[model samples]
Target: MGPDQALYVVATPIGNLADMVPRAVEVLQCADLVAAEDTRHSQRLFSHFDIDTPLVAYHDHSDDQRTARIIERLEAGETVALISDAGTPLISDPGYRLVREARNRGIRVVPVPGACAFVAALSAAGLPSDRFTFEGFLPAKSGARARTLEQLAGEERTMVFYEAPHRVADTLDAMAEAFGEHREAVIARELTKAFETFHMAPLAELAAWVRADSNQQRGEIVLMVRGAERKAGATLDDESQRVMKLLMAELPPKRAAAVAAEITGVNKKVLYNWGLEQK
Candidate 1:
């Protein structure tokens, strides 16, 4: 029997078309159908590469009907290729539902990896790439975004995030506030395209730079922040301990530790140990 039908998750270029892998092109050209995040936006890519495969829209709003249709095609031994408007399918894009359903139905899923904005940016950001977290995009609202940043303030793994042009400055300002002014960060903009730029500095300085230059606010942005330094013989601060005690009064020790970690960005283990010592 022929090899089992599969869904190919292909990655395209972030900006520069030259980065499109030959294998990805071949998969797109050969697939029976192409599931794209945005059919209109992907048209340019199809036109550029002369890929005439039938395109179907699949995005965040795509209902189960769409996914079911794709799975049905896969089950019938038809090959389908999934592509996001740019980069890899489902990095911060749609296709998760389709992929999951395909797997549950015993359909093989193959990844034709290529360009990814976060990976590309992290590779050259000069931060600790050994351990990193890709926190896709920040919340649109300033207050919510700040709260999210606060939760990750003590993250030891390098944090990567995507920000729209208009909110880039505000996001940087929030980062500066949540992670101290001296936290090192790298702002990579327009990556893999003409006018691509990378600016590295302390969080406060980076925020100031973006604020002063309107140009910096434009383009696709990947922001990388250095992980919190692990100090030797580190102990919980008095403020954190005080908060933990107050929480413990109203909640169980474990619950208090968790909440304290979220509010103060302190390590949960440390708080838990402190809580145990108190009891």
Candidate 2:
């Protein structure tokens, strides 16, 4: 409302410099101060836009003492802008404490939306976007990643995850194992850059491709894994699981799914994968 009463949470471009919105740039340029998750990284973005506003470091690693300082600035009627290194602040990055503190201190929190990699990837993932969940990034360790995947194994909504270049292949392999090798998925990398690529395929195929081509291992990666296809059967009894096996062994996937669908009233495509996963 008033000129000096708000803290703006601004979204910056993920990669492509041109993706920056004019209004976001203007806000950052005019803000009293910018509380950046990484002053050095944010400086690059600020320099790109020629924004000379002073930046104060505020990140997850920073303690409450730092938060107190930022809160003091806000309380003093400074219009601070919070920005992460890339994309939106607080998505998988820092900003929660500052936002909460600002609100608690009666400071207005304004969100100036712009480019977000997860949303951009989801729009083009070709998977069902109507019902989806953003998991940010999975744990790096094998057991942890597997446990994470296991918890989501039965989830029926599409899921998105961010993975570093070096870990994308390993994550994909883990996804294939936990979610089933044939689970449909897509990988979007170097998004909005000249080398931007989107690969849509079965999890197994993507994993294999990544292993075979070293080039696929580079760039910031956004993975979209199709949710577990719900099985429709009268409930998989000994008889049905046996029938599922025989049908999958004897008929093509399409025909098998159709037969399974008829037998259990579950969606054909979903039952088809359930049958395959059974194998």
Candidate 3:
């Protein structure tokens, strides 16, 4: 029997239907009512799982009255399952209002966790995961997007963003301009579907590649950008990095890198790679 007087925040599959959890299917099947972002779209999922539970539309545009109605049912000890069009609800999808109000009214809130797109992309992006930030979607317009990226130029955490298929190329261009062209990034597209891809390259190359191929511009996209390099040398100390930069202005790249390495006890190859990135 489904737990009553509680909201089960259910996670739906983003692309591949196989990712759906057995518990989520059980909860929905036994729920007294299923609150969905799109009732029609959710109908397909229900039909597939043979979940004949009633569905009520609840989304960003859901009015306070609509929320009041749902809360009323929950208070009456009815089981309500919340599911978005895809993935976990409220991760850039709707249902936050209902969940928020449910908690305020002392209704139980349970998470039936499963697939989440960003979490999956970050796991294999090859970027630092220890300390990362989820920035969600950036501004859609060029000027606004530039300003937003400019503000995050110094972010030390790996940045994650979702972008529409058509605007991805322009967004990558803006990111390359804001961050250095050499900054590394990954494009995860069509996630679990047949055309799934995870292409990682320097920002400039990635941007050019996406621009050149119309195929890269299509499908769901997750963009992961490496954080800004710590000014201190990867192999050397801060003073060594400063000295190497100063010497390169006057000496040849090879000579300056060699001199810096000899004086600082740092690897010459590492110093040389730094010089190449600067150029």
Which has the greatest TM-score? 1
Clashes of each: 0, 0, 0
lDDT of each: 0.90, 0.85, 0.90
Estimate candidate 1's RMSD in Å.
Answer: 5.2
TM-score of 1: 0.86
Tens-place lDDT per residue, model 2, 1-279, is: 223458899999999999999889888888888889888988788888899999998889999998898788878877888999889999999999889888887789999999899999999989999999999989989988886786677778999999988998899999998888999999999889988999999999999988898878998889999987665543455755666677878775546778977886666656655655554
Q: Which regions of candidate 2 are displaced past 4 Å?
A: 1-4, 233-279
Q: What's every prediction's RMSD, in angstroms?
A: 5.2, 7.6, 8.2
> What C-alpha lDDT does candidate 3 achieve relative to the native structure?
0.90
By TM-score, the better pick of 1 and 3 is: 1
Across 1-279, the per-residue lDDT of candidate 3 in tens digits comes to 655558999999989989999999999999999999999999888888899999999999988999999899999889999999999999989988999999999899999999999999999889999999999899988988986886677677899999999999999999998888999999999988999999999999999999999999998899999998766646567898799889988975557889998888888868865765565
